[model samples]
Each structure stands twice: as C-alpha cells, then as structure tokens.
Target: MNAKVRLGEFLLTRRSQLRPEDLGIPDYGERRRVPGLRREELASLAGVSVSYYTRLEQGQSLNASPQVLDAIARALRLEEAERLHLHNLARSSAADPGRRRSPAPERVTEATRQLLEALAHVPAILTGRRSDVLAWNRLGHALFAGHLDPGAPERPAQRPNMARLVFLDAHTRDLYADWPAKARAVVGHLRLVAGRHPDDTALHALVGELSAKSADFASMWADHRVMACTVATYRMRHPLVGPLTVTQQTLSQDPSLGQNIVVATTEADSPARTTLALLDQVTPQHGPARPTVRAGSG
Candidate 1:
C-alpha cells in the first residue's frame, strides 16, 4: 500500500467516526448526506484552512508538520495508538522517495528458541513481523493449531500466519469464542505494523491475500483502523480441554528483530490453569505429536 494513500485513508476514516454533537458542534437539525463532521468543520476545529486539510486528506500534502498532525489528531479525537499511527504514516511518506529497502528475512534466533523451550508448560509462540509463527512451544502448538502438521513452521512455505488463521481457517476460527473481535484485533495490529513498516512487501502481499479471501478482512482494511496489541484476554474453546480464558502478553525481543513472543497464561489455581496442565500432560513433550502450522488457503 502507498504511504500517502494510507495516511489519507487513516485521516478520512477517523474523521468520519467523530460526530459533530460529541465535539460540541451544533448541527441545527440539518439533513446531512455525510457521516460525522464535514471536512470544513474538522479543519475549523483543528485550526487549519479547509483547503489545506482537504489537500492533506487527498494525499497532496506530504510535508505535514508534527504540530499540524497533532492538531488534526486532536480534532479527530484519535486514541494514542491511532495518533502514533497517523504520524508514522505521514513520516513514511515524507522520507526520501529515491531509496528502497528489501524486507528482512523472517526467522527466530537461537536465543528466542531457547526462551520458548524454557516455557514448556506455557502456551507461547514466536511470531515474525507478519504474524507468522516462526516457532512455538509444544503446549502452544497443542493449544493454538493442533489440527495442522506440527513440523510446518520448519518449512517457510508452510508456516502458519496468525492473521490468516484468524480469518480463513475454520478450525482456528472455531477455537476463539469471540471470533469477530479476534479478527478485528488482528487487522488493527496489522495496520499498526503497516504504518511503521510501509516498505514491507511481504506485509502488503499478506494484506492483499486476506482482502481477496475474506470479506471481513476487506471491510476492516477499508476502515483503516490502527492498533498495537500489547496485552489482551481471550476466551478459547479447545476441543480436548473444553473452555478456558487466557491472557496473551506480547513481548518484544530486539528492536531490529521486529518479532514478538506471544505468551498465553491462565489465572493461578483457576480451572483454566488445571485444564491447561491436563492439555500439557496429553500433549507430548517432544515428538511427532507437535502442533501443525498449515499454509493458509485462499
């Protein structure tokens, strides 16, 4: 996706989400054709000319100052994550256009592998920038993708992408009690990454693939929402272990790695914890019974 177009879409989406009444603008009972505040109204509130705001939203204004972006962000009432995303999108577009860089190879370091191994009982997976499962512990495999071939992550062609699984894989979809919420979170996090890594071709390809395959993904992508997922609680239904609630924490290893270790844990002494322990017992420590990571089908 082009960075300018992304910035424009982000601005447009956020603008439409804010209602005039919420921002103390009097509507005067006028029949409105557009949702939320009009372009002029937003520009007025943001202390900018309507023409300038329009140019920014049309991708014509590439040199937006940080102060100007912040003013617009305030007018739109964007959350902290969304505000950061807006700045990233603008900054990406403002960078030297002549230079280009290839996406980094997605791989888990030996040290990260050792970390996953140390947390044998915890359902934990190491993911690359595209949410590709680079590696996972035995328990994580059993908990998240037990139906797929366990050795799939070892093959780059067969690595399972969490975003793809959330939207397209029926087994993974069924595992989540709140499937829609999970899907939205995936899209939001992907948007955040897209803003920060605008030159990532792999990410753009993944987004294209998902947009073509899943209507839900397409709609969410069009909305241009942005989010950084650090911690979340989710309800999951395991075929073997029944229902359980787990909190997922995303830990960043190295800044340059662009990878996260997603670890899921249940409450202490809770029934879900007991169920997870049982799952660990039934799942082999190291063997042919590993979790399968299938290539997502279109």
Candidate 2:
C-alpha cells in the first residue's frame, strides 16, 4: 500500500483499539455508532483540532511534524516500536515518490560468508530485510529448513522467505511447537519493515501475496502490531532430532545493507544442547569443508 493509505490505516486501527476508559476519560451514558475513541476525543487528547486530526486520519494531511506525531503517539499509548513506525510512516507519506531510490538486490558479501564459516558449528542463517534467506551454515540449514533444498538460498529466485515459510509452508509451521507466537512475531516484524520501507515494491508484493493466501497472516497483519526480531526463545520439533529449545538471536550484518545473521543456541550442557550437537553431526557437510567454506544457501 502507499504510505499515506498505510499511515491512515495504522492510525484508524490503533484508534479503534483504545477505549475512553483506557485513558481515564469518563464516559457518559450515550448511544455509540462505532467502537473505541472518536476522532474528536483523540484530537483533544493529542492537543490538535478535530478537523486536522480527521484530515490526517483520512490521508488528506501528510505534513505532520515530528512533535505532532509524537503527541499523537502518546495519546494512542503506542509502544516504542509502534511510535518509531508512526514516525517512519509519516515521513514516507510526505516524501516525494520521484526522489526515492529503488532498493538494490540483496547479497551476502565475502566478509559475511567468512563470518558464517567461522560460526559453522553454530546454527546461523543470514537473512535480508524482507526476511529472505541469503545464506546459512550447515547446522543452520538443518535446524531451520532441512525439508527444502539445502542450496536454495544460493539462487535469488529460489530463496525462501521466513514469513512465507512460517505461514504457508507446512514443514515450517510444524517446526514451531508454539506456532501462533512465531506467526505473530513474523507478522509484527514484517509490519515494522513495511513502515520503514514504504517504497519497497518487492516487500509490498510479498505482503500482498501472503495476505491473499493465508487467513492467519491477513488477521495478524490487520492488527497493526510492530516488533523487533532481536532475540526470541522457541521450542522446535525437528523432524530428525526431535524436540529442542533454543534461543534465536539476530545480529545485524550491516544497517545500510539491511542484512542480519540469526544464530540459534541452546543452554549449556542441557539435553537441548546435546540434541543440537547430534543434529550438527548428522547434517551433511555441504560444499568444501567448513572453516575454509564454500558458497551455499539456507
């Protein structure tokens, strides 16, 4: 969606989620036409006129100042991530489309490949901003996507998107013991990315495709939640190695490149750790021997 429309929808959705009682506003007995706070109520709370806030919410006003956006965010009780997203949307909505640069095709640099090789014993997958699998080490491939072709990430056209896998691929869906939590995290992070890169055609296309194909994804997307996929603990039901708990931590490779390295680790000397070690041993060594590495996929 365009930045203006996205900003409007986000504002409307968040407005609908709050009640007058949520912010200590006394409600008199009266018939209501819709849910949550009205535009007048929100405008009053944000210290703006109703007409201005209405214009903003209707996508007619795109030049909101940072102070005004911050005020609106405070009135809506937005979290840190959601507040950042609000500012991003507002900026994009005001930006000239002709001046925006098209995103470059994402690639894993040699330096990144060397880092992956250094973490060969650990489960590590490199992913792009839109959650596309750029590359992975042996254990990383086995832990996350052993069902798919091990070399799929080597080809851009064949790269697996983490969001798509979580919602649309049965194997990935089954891998997570608490599937709903994983699904929400993926959607939330995707929402944040969408706000940040409003001009990203491929990213928007992926969102549209997933929304059309999966009811679950559509519902989650409509919720307008935002999250950073920094560190999360998940229980995985690996087909070969059975159940194991691991903490997945995402490390940014480069902010300008919009690539991140996701590493999965288990607790020290735990059964999960032993299971991971077993998985490492059983996972075939692809290409050249690790530590000296060869090009591969996730």
Q: Can you list the residue pairs that collide in candidate 1?
A: 148-292, 149-292, 150-291, 150-292
Off by over 4 Å in 1: 287-298
TM-score of each: 0.94, 0.93
- Number of clashes recorded per candidate: 4, 0
lDDT of prediction 1: 0.89
Candidate 1 weakest ten by summed lDDT: 284-293
**Cα lDDT for residue 63, model 2?**
84
- Residue range 153-266, candidate 1, lDDT tens digits: 877898999999999999999999998888888999999998888998889999999999999999998988877788989999999989999998999876576799999999
- Candidate with top lDDT is 2
Which candidate tops TM-score?
1
- Model 1 TM-score relative to the real fold: 0.94
Model 2 lDDT per residue over 13-78, tens place: 999999888898887887678988999999999999999999999899978999999999999999
Task: Assess each prediction's global lDDT (C-alpha) against the native.
Answer: 0.89, 0.91
